[model samples]
Target: MASEILAQLQAQKLLIVNPRRKNGLIIYKKYYAEFAGPGAIVGGQFDCDAIAVLPVGKISLIVPQTPEERRQAYKMRRQWVKLTKQITDNPIPAERAQVILNQFEHWFDAQTVENLPDEAFALLVGVLPQTITKVRNNGLF
Candidate 1:
């Protein structure tokens, strides 16, 4: 049987993510990836191209959002962007990859990134997935 990624839901409208309960990923332009970890929100700002669940643990769904919940979601997205800007802005590919792993390590095991295909990272930074492997393997892999 084909293995399906869990919770590949389309955002017909805004979809807010609650990271304490659900970890999610939003894919943009078919390649660039945004991870929604604890407190992050995906479709809140705009409709997402695609969103899928990360198997972090038993999952929970987003409830109807309150004002405070929306605020938290927006705040997390800002933090998420701030975190990855380091990767996207840097000219060095290997250095960009290393910075992303360093950021991920602060929240979760850097190895948990294996949950997503290496190609995602490749596309995100415009490098070969092999580059991600080479950089990731050097430490905390």
Candidate 2:
């Protein structure tokens, strides 16, 4: 689902930042081990699933200074609904829209500091040419 969204975003020329890596064992030990047990260890990584489509003649920049600065940068980019709406409004079919929405929802669901599954991170990096092909065939976008 996320791969589908990424493909659509890229097609619309949106900029996507790489997601953050997760230290799976470290995170599990530090957080969930108390309830799930050591045997329930899981791991994953994440990228900022946020997409930013710069306004015409405008450029988007990412400057990673301190960790706090990086967080702020991501937050600002994530909250830019203008960019998202532009991409979403690109004449895509309803099915395509739903796929993108699902992916975005999944990313939103993983916004917490812990307990995010590895699959979420995997989705962060996955690509979906199939979605693009479908859109192209349907002449939706």
Per-prediction count of colliding residue pairs? Answer: 0, 4
Per-residue accuracy of model 2 over 3-108 as CA lDDT, tens digit each = 4433443443222232242111111121111111111111112222224211111112222436565555446444433334444454544444345434444444
lDDT of 1 by residue, 30-131 (tens): 555565556755553343355443433233446436878877777887787676765778887888777665655555554566565666666656667887
Off by over 4 Å in 2: 1-63, 80-94, 97-131
Worst 10 residues of 1 by lDDT: 1-10
Which pairs clash inside model 2? 19-46, 19-47, 19-48, 20-46
Name the runs in model 1 displaced over 4 angstroms. Answer: 1-9, 21-28, 51-59, 139-141
TM-score, model 2 to reference: 0.24
Per-candidate Cα lDDT values, in order, are 0.57, 0.31
Candidate 2, poorest ten consecutive residues by summed lDDT: 30-39
